[model samples]
Target: MSNLIHFKRDELSFQPYSGQPPERASICRLIGPDASSSMGAGLACFDGCSIEWTVLYDELIVVLEGHFRLRVGERVIEATPGDVIWVPERTPLAYEGDQARVFYALYSVDWQARNA
Candidate 1:
């Protein structure tokens, strides 16, 4: 397998999210197991919407624009630009915010397998 991969700015195409409260955000996947071995990366933008999710793997998210509120059970974390949020597997969480943009890396090889 090749060791080099690149996603140029022009190559990114954000599409409407299929998850709950679809209007909340759009996502553009950059890398996945189809391109790598054990991890995947993507870009997401949210606009004043919240979605409850159960994570299946470890995830690292970095805010790039605006702010985001992550509710993990009873704990709520406010994330701003440059902030990194680490979410562990099997955690039930809710992501909500207004005009938020983030970069995320998920450590899971079967993400696509399950999502697909």
Candidate 2:
């Protein structure tokens, strides 16, 4: 891998997340085990969709545009541009947004290994 990788959002291929409700939710993997050994990074966008997930790894999310909301257990938190949220492993979270673009990084080398 190169020391630096450049990406133009419009040029990246984003796939609809099959695990989530297919209501304009898409993700593009920017870095993973294929790119790095320490962590994985990605960009995700959602609109008018609420989805639940059981996080298997520590994750840091930064809102890039619009409002993004997350229901972590009993706590509800809203994040906007420049806002950052950290979610621990083994947490159950519900996410929803009107229109949001987020950049996320997971502190795990292999999420499937821990999840499975």
Candidate 3:
């Protein structure tokens, strides 16, 4: 038997992202530590909002819908559908978007545990 699993976008259950405004962002964790020991994958939806945080793990973000923006230092990177953004670990950045949906994969599913 194969370990492959398929997920439907419509069936995903999104939860409010911690520390984010309720109306601004939500996330659906598709793959985590239980599925992959070293990586995590998820879908995130964002409204017109900006969130600032420091990443503890390297991340790759693929824009699925609408527009997304990443602000690192004085530079701002923008993405649309079919665009991909790479964020290195320990980078301080601001995530901004308007009606955007993105798929994100990150190294280190245990980042929170390791950082804490």
* TM-score against native, each model: 0.86, 0.89, 0.93
Instruction: Report the poorest 10 consecutive residues by lDDT, candidate 1.
Output: 16-25
lDDT of each: 0.85, 0.85, 0.91
How far out, in Å, is residue 26 in model 2? 0.8
* Worst ten in a row by lDDT for model 2: 17-26
Q: What is the alpha-carbon lDDT for the whole of candidate 2?
A: 0.85
Candidate 1, which segments miss by more than 4 Å at Cα? 19-23, 112-116
- lDDT, residue 43, candidate 3: 93
For candidate 1, list the clashing residue pairs, or say none.
Answer: none
- Compare the candidates by lDDT and give the number of the best one: 3
Task: Give each model's clash number.
Answer: 0, 0, 0
Q: Which stretches of model 2 miss by more than 4 angstroms?
A: 19-23
